[model samples]
Target: MAGIYIHIPFCKQACLYCNFHFSTNKKLIPQLVNAIAKEAFLRQDYLTETIETIYFGGGTPSILPTSDIVFLIDEIKKIFEVNSNTEITLEANPDDIDEANLVAWKKAGINRFSLGIQSFIDAELQWMNRSHNAKQAKHCIDLIKKYFTNYSIDLIFGSQLLSNEDWLVNIKTALSFNPPHLSCYALTIEEKTVLGNKVSKKVISNIDNEKQAQQFNILMKELAIAGFHHYEISNYAQPNFESKHNSSYWQSKHYLGLGPSAHSFNGSTRSWNIANNALYIQSIENNNLQIETEELTTTQQLNEYIMIALRTSGGINLNIIEERFGVTILLELKNKITAWLQANHIEQKNNFIQLTNLGKLYADGIAADLFF
Candidate 1:
């Protein structure tokens, strides 16, 4: 029903395309881990429901020692009610995956892994400045498969380095490993990232939208042919293998986020920890966790739901909308979606208005059109 997200804000190296809140300072690891555990205990009442998932995300969670990982999980269990079969996931990069670490992680209560194997091509991996090589990427999957059954691979498409043929090779290589789930994201250039800077200075070209769209289509078709469900816009999974933690966000389930730059959501409000690691640790150690909070208006919540629900295969549930926001609002939503329905971008399934495969390409634009 709910989840907990712990942000580990340290990485072995900085990737060229990343703009996330993280540090190359490994010295902060011990302090940050202890601070995160304390933060979890302090915010124990944020989610009232039983915890279905616990996700360790960040710059790279696998950078932690196995003992630290165990201590954190034990700390969380002491303060919260975790599900017996909870999906405790650690986001890892391939370079950090070795037999010893994998064995230790399994014993440390990490039942799932979301591997950051962005590409299986050495050239592309180098282009992204990834810490792992293509060989490590393949080897890690084989290692993880020996331990966890409910694991996911993270892949990136729409890179200028990836041609349609190269994208197919990446997909096929991942599928060959039979990972239960795959999350394929389009490479977005943020102004603060190294790649973004290059583009700003005209040192390199940006991603071509037409090429990106073509690769996405190829991704969908290939995944579907391989019997993976297009459950969310960026996610594909075999049956019953969808990510529980990420799904909770789309379903608007309450969760507690710990550590720097992590965000938490209750039904009506959103709060986020400060992005600066030093400041976050300092504040938490002082027994005052600093975060910016915002209370959502009814219209804001409705629009948020519209945006999230439309991206999902379940689409918008007319019944839930009516129940929560009133019948009048639901009727207006229906009226707003009439054009999309007529254009065959979206279709109705009983009370659900979901995107057609074609509509998935324009998911954001369509969701904006239906916004309150």
Candidate 2:
């Protein structure tokens, strides 16, 4: 099955650590939405299969008025063949969520939410320059429970300000809310972000890998004990609560992405729209979209497959590799896996190779090592 991703490239404020393509300027919101809808029709045949998921991710989709949100969804439905039981998700910030907005969002056909409740601590919020405070973070969860049952909350761990105690509180607080899904990420300071600048200037310390590893271990142990499935490296969910759209991505399903800075992948090629808002809108206004694409080579595809599959709970399926890429590649992969298995970094059972707790900490390195 296929999926659709609509990028809403507007936010009320910029977070200190965010490097996403978004503008704090709300004046371009209408044009951006219209541009995305137009792009949908332009790329209508990109995915030949029926659409199974529609994800509204962005600077903050919840920042949009209910009418704008509805218009986007309606436009998508008109242009694409969406299944009746399609998973429609919106990414929202805590400050933008309220009873009225939550009710309106639900009514507008959004079945899932990925709330940006980065932390349940006021200090951490301040450090990140988040628009919402701790109280709003907590209150928004309450409102979400009242409106939508299938929701996920995002939490950031391993910030310099977040001690182990604070990290525990953040995890426990999310558990207290009983969200169906949780996506906890270790904070990384990207090169162009404000957090990165601070690190370069020594105003704030860089991320301590050791502390981050500790926090990740805590997440695994606690979430496992709490009955949450560690479905992906950065995601946890209750039974049957896995994110269909994201899972489609990890499984290398085709999807059409509409809007500036959005990426689309068919089985063999990858395309991405331009990142500039005004340029994207202007080009689409002229009935053209500035995009770049690359066709994957056999080796590139195999390496990508190994990287993505290794990060998931299902791990790498050797049989699929043998069938698709041939026995030679499969034998090469098996020989490499032998090293990790001997090091206690990977466990093999039932023809699947999955990361151990120590392996998860070095997932990227291991995936890179296994790359062809």
**Candidate 1's residue-wise lDDT over 242-350, tens digit each?**
9999999999999889999999998889999999998998999999989999999999999999999998998899999999999999989999999999999999999
Alpha-carbon deviation at 21 in model 1, angstroms = 0.9
* Residue 282's lDDT in candidate 2: 99
**Which residue segments of model 1 deviate by more than 4 Å?**
none
Q: Which 10 successive residues of model 2 have the least lDDT summed?
A: 98-107
lDDT of 2 by residue, 66-172 (tens): 99989988998898889999999999998898888877888889999999999999988998999999999999899889878899999999999999888999999
Give the Cα lDDT of each candidate. Answer: 0.93, 0.92
Q: Flag regions of model 2 displaced more than 4 Å.
A: none
Question: What's the TM-score of every candidate structure?
Answer: 0.98, 0.99
lDDT of 2 at 232: 94
Error of 2 at 149 (Å): 0.5
